[model samples]
Every structure is written in C-alpha cells, then in structure tokens.
Target: MHASSRRQTNCCRKPSTSGAKAPDLGNYAMSLTAALNTALMGLSTIQAQTGVTSGNIANAQNPNYTRKMVQLTTPAVGGDPMAAVVAAIVRAAAPNLLQDYYGATADYSRLSATTDQARQLAEALGIDDTGGGQTPLQSRLTSFEDAVKRLEATPEDTTLKALVVQRGQELAKEVNRLASQRTTLQSQTQDDIRTGLDTLGDATKAIAGLNAKIIGQKAAGMPTGDLEDLRDAEVAKIAGLVGVRTITAENGAMSIYTDAGVQLVGTTAQSFSYDSTTGTIRNTNGDNVTAGFSEGSLRASLDYLDGSAGALTSSDGNVGAMEKFFNQLNSMARNIADVVNAAYGSNLFNYTAGDAAATLAIDGAFTADPNTLDATRMGAVQQAMRNTTLTATQINPAGEPNGLSTANVNIFGLVSGVMAYHARQVSDNEAARDSAENLQANVEQKFRNLTGVNVDDELAQLTVLQNNYAALAQVMNAIREMFDEVISIGR
Candidate 1:
C-alpha cells in the first residue's frame, strides 16, 4: 500500500470528503428522508384544505350555516434542512362581524314578535276595512248606533227594543272572543320560547364534546380539521337559535358564551332545561332563565312579544297593551250596561264589575231572546250604543241633546283603536322577520367565503408535491450512479 493506502488500511475508515461513496450515500438517505417528509406534509395540507371546501359546499342550502377554516402551524424538527413538519390543523377564530349580526338578531326577533301579535289581533277584529262586512267590529258598531237612532224615533216600539238587545249581545260576544284569543296566543308564544332554549343548550353541549375530541387529536399531531368543520356547522346552526360567542384557548380548546355574556362551555358546560308543558326555561341548576349569550331568533321573539305588549298602558292600571285593550273593552261593556239598565231596568249587557271581572264576562257566543222585554226599547238602546261617540255632543239624554251622562256605546272608539293598533303591530313584525331572513343569508355567505374548502387549490398543491418527490428520487438515483463509478475504479 502507498502512504495514503497504508494510512487508510491502518485507520480502518473512509476519508472525510464531499465525494466519498459512503458519506454520499448517507447524504442521499438524509435528502430522501427530508423529501419524503415534505411530501407527506404537503399531502396533509391538501387533504385538510379539501375537507374544508367540501363542508362549505355541503351546507350551501342550509340557511343557518356558518363557514369553517383550517389553520396550519410549523413543527420544530431536529436540524434537518429539508424536512417539512406540520404541527397541527386548527379551526379559524370566529369573526367580529358575527357579534354585530347577533345583536341585530336580538333586536329583530323581539320587534318581529310584537308585530306578529298585533297583526293577529287585527285579523281577528276583521279590520280589512274594505267592505262593510269586512270590518265586523266597525260594522257592528254602526248597526248598533243605527238601532239606537231608530229607537229615538219609536222609543215605545217593542220590536225595536228587541233589535237593540240583539245588537248589544253581538258586540259583547265579539269582545269576549278577542280577549280569549289573545290569552291563548300569549301562552303559545311562551311555550315556543322555552322549547327553543332547550334545543339551543343541547347543541352547545354537543359542540363542547366535539371541541375536546378535536383538541385531543390535534395534540397528537393528527389532522382534525375535518371533524372541526362538522363541529363548526353545528355551532352555526345553534347560533341561529341563540346568539353565541366563542373564545379560542392556547391548547386548541374553545370556550363558548351567549350574546348575553353567559358562559355555555368552558371548564364545564352550562346547559339549559325547558318545560314544554309549563313553558318555563331555566339553567342546568334549575334557576330561572336568563338570555345569556344566546342571540338566536327564539330569544328575539320572546323579547319583542313580551316587551311591546307589556309596554301598552291604558287609563286603567293594568300593564301590557293587550291588557289595556281588555280593560278598555270591559269599561265599554260596563258603560253600555249602565246605559241600557237605566233605560230598561235590567243588567242585560254588563261585563262583571270590579273585583269580580270573571263573572261579568259575556259569553263569546250570543243568542237573542225576544220574549224578555219591549222590542222597541231594546232596539233604540242598541242603536244609541253603536253610534255613541266618546265625545259628550254625541249623546241625547233626559231632554238634553248634548248631555254626556246616560250615553253608552262610546266603547266603539276604544275597541277600534286598540284592535287596529294591535293588528298594525303584527303586520310590522312580519316585515321585520322577512328582513331578518335576508340578513341571515348574507351572514352565511360571509362565513362560506372565510372557511370553505376549495378542491382546486388542494389539487394544485398535490401536483407540486408529487413533482418535488419525483425530483428527490431522481437525485438519489444520480447519487447511486456516482457510487457505482467509485466502486468500479476500486475493482
């Protein structure tokens, strides 16, 4: 062996040089490992991105859908120059615009509810106002007033008195029916609100469980973006039922709150329970309900119906516009009864007097009894009641043409005003609900843009990773060729 060979034989190792066969092969192995890792990471990115796009497309038809996005972070690897390491796939943080949308939802819901209640009341009162028969309450009032004027012409006519009694009964029946209908609608509204809250809470709990699953997988360096999109879809659905705000934590966990700032999920889930029968809503601890962060339409409806109706005040101390209406109706009924009684000496059409309002209620169903009294007197009384204006000038009593006393039927103004106001409110709410639906559509579109999966983007990336992986393999082949040449020379 020459000096270099002798030294090589004694050292029992290859020389350290860039072109050394063994060292070059080791370098090739390292390069291949790096390239392989890069390819794998690129593949994962493509898959995650694809899943997000798929989710967006799937929920396009859903009105309450919110979009989802995948988040990527780099991983630290030992000093390897060529490897690509992906730390985890995360869901996008919620947007600030959602807060604004939720607030609008709350307002619209309440307002719409009030509007709806009013509309229904108006419909019940037959206030289309197009034809004489269309506005039953108004027409009925006119008929009664006409009867009273006829009675003035023939106060002693028994047939006219009977007609007046019949007309009075008809008006009383209509008023009673309206009051009962309002009570039924209010009860139904309460039930709907309670049921909605229960559904919302159940959804929140499910999302919390999903959060745990997603974070656990992420910590293990797995692709959890697909599952994350499902969770987000569910959350968005829940959002439409109630307003929800979210907070992202350091460990890939999320905490949820209601628009009202009540926590739904964190260290533990704060859930709600609703009684369908009683129409009561409460928290997991069975406490009375609070709106919390729920910004959904259900809460909106409750606030609108309750607040607007409750705000209506009448001359009487009763609260709620609906109650005011009932009070006015009762007052009118009393006034009518007093007038009729003074003229005919009988309590024929009085709603129950104070403290015993229940008994004074006339049956909503009316039937005339012609045999009980003078028909002419009854007819005159009925006509006067219908035309009786709230103003004193409308009445003629005890030989006084303008005397306000002894005049009955002024309730026409109160009944018409209260019923009409309620109806207009309902119509307004219907319009508001339509507007809210449009807003919800716009919000969903925004969510889609942020979080939707684009298959084209993933496919493009896949092609790039494939080409790079092929290039790395080619480089390995070239390195092998050089090693083969070195081996041949030694041979």
Candidate 2:
C-alpha cells in the first residue's frame, strides 16, 4: 500500500520479454523487508529524540547545562528518502549573552570589594555614617582641648593639671591605636590575596584538565554537553576573582585569558603567586599585576591598600582610602608634636621623630608628678593649639607625609578632614557597587532567558515522542503480518 511497495509490485507485474508473466517471490520478499527497515529507522529516531528531551528535563534546574537536540536526516535508496534518522546531537546556547553575563559578574565583584572595605574602615575608625556619634579621635581631641582650657583657668590646681595629662594620654593612645590598625589591616589584605591566588590556581588547573577531556570526547563523536557544562561553571567561579575572556575551539579546548590579555590558560593552566613582604600579586611570569588589575576582587584589594580618589599613599605611587587615612594620621601626629614641643620646650608629649603616630605618648614626668606641671606653659599650650596649623611636610615612617591643605586648620580640623575624606570614599564606592550589581542581574537574566532549560517544553516533546514510538511499533507489526501471509501463500 505504500509508495515503495506499490513501485515494487508494479515492477514485478511488468510483462516478461519471453512472453508469459511468472510469480516473482523475490520482489515481494524485498518489499516486506524494506517496509520493516523503514519502521526500524523511525523507531531509532524516536528513541534519540526521547533521550534528548529527558536530558533537558533532568537538567532544568542546572544553569550551566546546555539544551541538546537531535538533528534528523533521511536515507534514500534511489531518489527518495526511506525514513528520518538522527544525524548527530548538538547543543543550544547564546555565546555572546554568556560572555556579557561573565563580564558583569567580574565588575560587580570588584566594586563590592571596594565598597565593603570602605565600610570596614568606617567601623574600625569609629566614624559612624548613620548619624552616630563622632569618631573616638574627634571626641578625644575635644576632651584634650577642654582639659587644657580648664587647666589654663586654674594655674595652681593639681587636679586640673592631672586631668590635662590624662586627656592627653587618651588622645595619644587613640592615635597610636589607629596607626597600629593600619598595619593589622595590611597583614589581613595580604592574607586575602594569598587565599584568592590559591582559589585562582585551583580553578585554572580544573579548567585546563576539563579542556583536555572535552577535546577527547568531541573527537570520539560523543556528546560533550555535560563536560562543557562543568567547564562553564569553572569559568564563572574565577570570573569574580579576576576579569577574564574565554574562547572555545572547535575541538572543545577552551583558552582563558585576563581581559588585559594575560593568558591564564592555554595548552596548560597558569599559576598566580602572592608576595606577603611586598603585598603584591604576581602571575607565573612574575609581573606585578596588583596595581594593574582593572576589575575583580584583586582590584578591590589593591584599592583597600591605598585609595581611589585624590588619596595620598606612603610610597606606592597610588592613592586609596587606607593610604590616605594612614598618611593623614601620621602627618597630624608629627605636626601636633612639633608645635607643642616647640612652644612648651618641656616635651609635653613624647614620640619617635620618624614614626610619631605609633609612638605618641604623654610625658611620664607630668603624669608622675602633677606639681611639675608648668601652669605658665598652659597659656603657651593654648596658643600652640589655637595658632598652629598643619601646613608643612612632616615625618612618615613609611615615606613622605604630605601635610594638610594650606587652609590653616587647627588640630581638631585636621582630624575632622580625615573623617570627611573617608566618608566621601564610602559614598562613591557604594554607588558604583550598586550600579554594578544591577548590571550583573540584568545580564544574568538575559542569559537565562536565552539558554536556560524549560521543563514544560521538554515534557511536551516527550509526550509527542511517546505517541510517535507507539505508531512506529504498530506499523512494524502490520508489516510482520503481511510478511506471514505471503510466506503461507508461497508454501
């Protein structure tokens, strides 16, 4: 009844050149076999389609899994096709959308690091942004000035003299504590970089190893969708640690590189190292990439060590929040010491000339005996506090400490400026971080819309495949019945 069977029957019915038409058992047998093979081809195609649909449904929740589909093909005996057969499996995804998502992820990580560090600094300095009280440094400065004024009014009060020394000790202790905090934060930053490098090394090695496996699987004509999934997940992980670009070859080997063109993975994986002494991150080639990092957690770490705005650094030739904070503290400490010591001449406060901030302390002579306090110098101390402004270069244990602007500010004003500088940093970096988070979310959603699996769609396809499989089975059974009737007729 089919076209191929009809064609065979019509050919078999043709008149013989010798004159009489004889029964052609061979042609009938071939027709039945041809019908059976056609049904088998349809059945095989249905099986492949079902498998692909099942895989899609199974991976519906997996973001990295790419959807797979069977490409249908047909075989022809002479001119027309017999039945459709699955040619090969292919994966579906938008490569450009995926790359954009990865880019956003890297940017978000960089800004988040910058913002979080600013908040950490604000907390450590006791400078509250949410209408909280003044920084301990600011309050201590006020208390010290008040004690000096009280002592100035009562030249012979031993209790007043002792109070001035007490307040001065508190103020000096606060400066030393803040300067020490910078050193502690520096050590912590180095440790974070070391941990990041370790994670980066592991990701690169895993990606490179996956690349080799993918190449082999693809060459063997196997479905490499799962392997590709693993590789993509690995890439996404390190994308936050450093900004990177990836290119996948036809053979399935993926090459990764920094956005700045530093090759991270080629035929083999690249390794990164962290130097605790210099607080620098280096690639396997020993290049100093700390200041060069444009977008990532590593970039944020560099900013934490310095600052982003018109921040002053110790000697690294870069400016950031921590750098500005450290330099400003040291400058203020030495300036205060120089003026107070010059005016009183009895060394009211003691500090090492090189590192004044870490060594600032109240003179033990005054604390030991309040009677030794020079009430005559109290007026000089007031004049020193009121008239003196930190407007010149000062000692820096690390490097040159650029003093306050030539605006002629008192000690309290200098301390206030440092707080204002950090507040601005927190505001700017937080805004940038919020913008990056929005961009990352938008890009990620776009990627998911384009390539993410749909369970309902796959389930519908599975239902259609089941119906088709049943139809093919019925067609094969009919062909078997026709073959039996012909065999009985031949006997």
- Which lDDT values do the candidates have, in the order given? 0.56, 0.78
Runs of candidate 1 exceeding 4 Å displacement: 1-80, 83-85, 92-94, 128-133, 149-160, 224-242, 273-281, 290-325, 335-348, 353-410, 453-491
**What is the C-alpha lDDT profile of model 2 across 1-491, one tens digit per residue?**
69999899988895658876767877999988988999998998999899889988998888778888788888899796899988778787788888887889899998887777877777677876436667898888779878988888998898998898899899898988887887677778777777887888999999999999989988998878788888888898788878889988879899998777777889999888877666677888888766545668876786566433333533322236566666667766776777777878768888654432346888888888867878778888888877877553433333544323434677666777767766766788789889999999999887777677778888989999999999999999999998888888889
RMSD of each: 8.6, 8.2
The residue ranges of model 2 lying beyond 4 angstroms of the native Cα positions read 1-26, 129-131, 285-293, 306-320, 338-346, 353-357, 379-406
Q: Estimate each model's TM-score.
A: 0.68, 0.85
lDDT of 1 at 322: 44
* Best model per TM-score: 2
lDDT (tens digit, per residue) of candidate 1 on 1-491: 49989887879975668764343545655654565566566556655555555665576555444445455565546754433334444544346655555545555554555555555555666665545343676666667667666765776776766676566667666666655664576666667676666777677777788888878987788766556656665666566666677787866677877767767778667777655444345777887655463356565444433323223422211114344444445554555566555555455555564421222332233234544555445554654455545543233222211102323335566445545555555566677678876786676456555644445654565466566656656665665666566556555
